[model samples]
Target: MQTPVHGSLLKPLQVNEAVGVWFHFSHSGSTALPHLPADILKWSKNYQNITYGVLDTPFQTVTTYANNSCLLLLDGRIDNLATLNDAYQISDPSVQSVVWYLYVTFGIKGFYRLKGRFTLVLYSVESEKTMLYRPYLSGFPLYYQSQEGGYTLSTNPLQLCDTKNSVTPLDKQRVAHYFTADPLKFSSHPFHSLSKLEPGEIVLMDAEGVEKIRQPVHEAFPKQAIPTQKDAIYRAYRRLIETAVSETLREDIDYGIMLSSGIDSATLAYHASKLLSKRGKKLIAYSWKLPNDAADESEKVKALCETLEIELKLLSAEGMGPFDEVGSMAYNPGSPVTNAFARLNRECYKLASRDGIKYLLNGNFGDMLFKYGQPKLTELWKERQFGQLLLALKRVSKKVIPAETQVRTPWLTDEVKSLRKEKTHSETGKTDYRYALCDFHEDYFGGERYLSGVYGITRLEPHRNSALVNFCLQLPQTLHS
Candidate 1:
């Protein structure tokens, strides 16, 4: 039978995997829950004792080996497949097949060989063991929990509650941090049972036991900007952006963009213009501003879109376009629980619905690849006075990094601390940011049994595109800064 594909699948291995739509609040850990959704249950029953993984949603992917010994799900885009695809000998153009083949080809090495930001899961049948993992350098959600010894993984909290005994109390410290306006976001949640996957590490479960491995992000990445010295970074960046654009536009649907006034979106739009010029596709740009909010700069976004000569749709704190606002959020699934990125997503969904566009093309992680978050910190570290850098990091965390946002909380914090402690470590084969990068990837970039399980949209992040990742990994910090 031909596999029907959405973005990802929520294959309910147990009864709780089939969650009722009534779950409103987020919970911690995996479970065996009551009120399983019929669709989930019915789908699970369709599989033989050997289960197959499928997408829980568009961004969430679930895939079980044909033998049923394993079940897996992934979130993110792979950009470097010309060779990997050739290695897998997969003629099929779909990402799933390439991924499955990669799994069959190299097992965990399969994970290492791939690039992009995601959170994923891999379960073993023989031992009923589950493995969770995240990569060192990434910007994706990865939270996991184990109850009754059975592990559950996701990019979001609510998904785990679909199981039994999954609902637990929230962590007040995390809540206080958020309410008090601390920058620790996402590392620790109010709910117990959930744990963020440390960056650049893999959580593995087997008959013997559960384990984790730290896979470093850079170093293995050659510090060159392009494959050839003859190529200018700007021109190469432009071509690569075009590649990212084409891959995203692979889906057959109307599309829109999340227009940030910054260079990231500006550059993305520049390449998009070249792509759409011939097709006469009027790229729809979505921008947002704050009316009563604390911080917002939608006017810059408006100005940028105008400069690019692209169609623009402006938004306010009030709401998105004419689409049934609430319904679209319901449809997005990644919203609400997804935090800051979630709000930005709402704008995308609203614009998509308004433009009659089925697909929304966002260059979300382009900033990460470009190191767009805090320009001066990296520079400060390079200039010495690491003390000031640490203080600045702490200062930023209080405001910029949320207790929950991976970069703001544990991932970035640990990285900063480690960098301070491990001056000689990089030479001895131990590095700080590189280590954190690995942990972040395995935990969040859709690794074996990782967390942050949010698979509810036809989501696309090409910045981590394998080719883009490969290229970025080879660049000097200056390029990223």
Candidate 2:
């Protein structure tokens, strides 16, 4: 058996904790990180102790820092030496080295300085204090259980691999929300234990239990600063590419990028190709050839890849008929998001497995991360950063009236904002954002336990880095300008 990377569940102790929240705390309990090693075949008894894994490179390092006192697991790469040096006094040396330094220097507070889409855990071995955090709106899928008799956290549900702690099932109200909720925020999952940490949240857990103390996602969504309309679009657009490209390549394994004809993938592919071209390595590109072969974007895809000089790996959509069939036949909790996207991910996993690649990047979560749905902008925009807000509005407009947006047109129309609900702090008995964030929790993002069970493949969405999102969120309304 391959050695387990992280310490085996020496004991999958039944810890009653809380689930699904967006929060942070002043004084909290300890946290833990249980990460499997890269090379371990299997862990000790019941997979209790890690047999394999290390953090030597950026590609496939599933480094788990544990003790009787703590546990931390991550799915991201940190790239801010100057920030690190200024914050923790760790100079530019290497990512792993800096991680150790930061760990030694700031313990929990240091996390704020971390810049990536990493799903992290802090378990207090002594206090049994536990807390989990995904990057602030970086958009890593963080499934958790915050109820009696069960409290577990995992990057994806599959990693936990225990039925006792898995989801039990859900009620009909959640199903109703899943099917008809406006904007369709609630997700569907058959197993009961599942819940996602809302974007821009810091969850705290302890003996008493877990509570997501709310915080603002952004002020009224108008967004932060910008100097000009053109600058807003340019910065937002560039930030997306810069984030997606630089961060995902941190895994300690051979990595690949998912490519397709869509602007999203093309955009990622465009930047990746440029980066890989500089190094002597060809950007290993993977694409899913649809089973029907009718919706083929082959010409556009091929032309782009060739122009960029990227090495391509084309996988058949039907190649994994057995795995797909098996997953569908037994469990697959009718994911409301998009199965085609999941299938694309599955195919990417197959590509990784077949070619011995450990890490692969895909364009998932970009829609939510970038808020790709343009129409929502009018409702979300805050006035503090009008210049930046206008640029985002323009990009959003392109999606709404693509042809018309191609030519210059008057972008700001208050009529749209007038039609939408105002995000007033005082009117709803809410002055700070935590209230609405919690409202999103109780009413929308969390509270619904769906698909808390089932095997989910590991996917790297580098663009969901916390630093990038916070930068976007914290920007003045016109920063994009």
Candidate 3:
């Protein structure tokens, strides 16, 4: 089915159209023949009460399945297609096809069996029930708008508009929380009228309105016995890293990876090079060349690439003006740009697009998943652990990185202070390290994911594997070293 290209369509789609929306409009007798945004209406078809529109995005893997009565649209890649196809007795299953097979084979419980980053919409004419689902740690996004007569859903928020197709104002409260306070405070869409689907969530919408069906967190991160031996833990961790990287590599695409001197990116680059080499493919690595004012890690990045024998591409962040693109990007995801770092990130993607690179893997969030949490020294002090408190303070004070850019936001600063007043007793003065890491992870990854979509690049994070995150979280804080 043809789809509408909405406002703020990414320029990368002009060449490689990949991302798309599978919008389902269910109409009733009193609904007066529901309408979608003009873009959808232009290319959509109505079969019975449902109208489906698929928006084209760059480097998106979309699969569709229809057996007369049931229809499904899947947007995103399936890492385990071969395994799933064999288990389901199907040939070359797409992500959505696997979902359909499982749903048919094991009922709704089948969704839990699939892995990879994907968003799906399923409609069953027999049950007259339409379901929307997103996997845990989904790299894609989905938005929905529920109204009195009918509801609308799409992968692009721009498609979920009023009858006149006018856009709503920015959600200032949520914007403030994300910018100054807690980025995880609200996972909902930045638009006031629409809601964003959270990871590990499934929602069913019918004539009765929207009802959420929470899916069980996949055993990707099960509570396994932590290996006490450092060697055993390191070996297991290395295996996890290898497996996650191997699974995410797409044979059809020549993917590049983000490389820095940092352990996270460097580690992934090392493993990725080995795996890709086995198949006789040379991995290409990209590193940001920031202005001289910024810390230059080019020497370190070059050393790793040379050692690994991977082709290195350095994208310059010198001439990229930070303030100019802020307005446009703010509307892309309906969220404010956090800092100057976001500018560098966008520039990197733009450079990738110019060089014809569609997939870029990064090792972000590696610290959060590992035993990177610091002990709450203040909490220890309250219990009269004077020795531990001093040690904790020394550890925390050892390293401090200054902010890249500072903008004066008096109102935002005051409002955030007010919001923090409602913190729990444990969070009033001092907070646990895990809590801080969780907040940072949510904010950092959440914004990055959305922005990458805007730049028309599929950003992969093998390090964000659920099993890896769970294992790290289970480790003792003392093991953080």
Best of the candidates, TM-score: 3
Model 1 TM-score relative to the real fold: 0.57
| Residue 105 displacement (Å), model 3 | 5.8
> Which of 2 and 3 is the better model by lDDT?
3
Residues forming the 10-long window of minimal summed lDDT in candidate 2: 446-455
Which consecutive 10 residues in model 3 have the weakest lDDT in total? 402-411
Best-performing candidate as measured by lDDT = 3
Clashing pairs in 3: 18-57, 18-58, 18-60, 19-57
- Residue range 229-299, candidate 3, lDDT tens digits: 55565566667778888877857556777665554566677788888788877677777665564455677
TM-score of each: 0.57, 0.53, 0.64
Q: Candidates' lDDT values, in order?
A: 0.44, 0.42, 0.52
Candidates 2 and 3 compared: the better one by TM-score is 3
Ranking by lDDT: 3, 1, 2
